[model samples]
Target: MSLCEIVRLEGYIQSSYLAVYPDKIMLLDGCCRADVPMVLDYIKTTLKRPVTDLKVVVVTHMHPDHAGGAHKFREETGCLIVSADKKKQWYSGIGGRTMHFVDIHLGYYVARRQGRPLKNLYYSASL
Candidate 1:
């Protein structure tokens, strides 16, 4: 039996999870880019592991609060970045890129019009 340890990282307005499995580490919601240091420190100190040990960084969506640190995490950890779902079109090539851009920008525009910050809005689960 494998024990999975899940840690909820603090300080970020958006909640993020670090799930440590026996053989793999999966980060759910990369948090803001500004939270990178805190997240990395938590993984190293609390988990007693190096950043490179992370196997996957799953970004639930392209929202800044959820995926802002994904690029940095990938660059730093050399981990594979995967989407939360198996929908190929939703995360695959040109179409995926276009969709992400459209969704994020449209979300921002709507939030702005409503006098709310996008970061304060909770993104729906991809699944």
Candidate 2:
């Protein structure tokens, strides 16, 4: 068993990563969706799982925050990227990633006060 951690991205976007093995990495939010730039990967690597050794990438939603980099990860890690909604998983590569649309409601919301796409914009450097 390896270590697991919930990496907070730009905003509400959170990605979880786990190192089931020293050389095996499980990216809960593999899409670079949050655009944390190695935050999650760092955590995973800190647990002895380097990106090169990674073999599993998991995407939570179709939103950019969770599916933006789905294609990149698959190319780099050569790992099986898992996600939901076949249409949502867009990647120009073979065995890019796995998209499995689960039958569950994940509460999504937009901040009425901020009037921004808070629902998916986590790493918003816009001020």
Across 31-107, the per-residue lDDT of candidate 1 in tens digits comes to: 76656778888778988888887878887766656776777778888888887556453435777666666666665
RMSD of each candidate? 6.1, 9.3
Q: Count the backbone clashes (under 3 Å) in each candidate.
A: 0, 6
Q: Candidate 1 local accuracy as lDDT?
A: 0.69
TM-score for candidate 1: 0.64
Clashing pairs in 2: 11-122, 33-65, 81-98, 83-98, 83-99, 83-100
N/CA/C clash count, model 1: 0
Which pairs of residues clash in candidate 1, taking residues 3 or more apart in a chain or in different chains? none
| Window of ten residues with lowest summed lDDT in model 2 | 98-107
TM-score of each: 0.64, 0.47
- lDDT (C-alpha, whole model) for all candidates: 0.69, 0.47
Total backbone clashes of candidate 2, pairs 3 or more residues apart or in separate chains = 6
Question: What's the distance in Å from true for residue 79, model 1?
Answer: 0.8
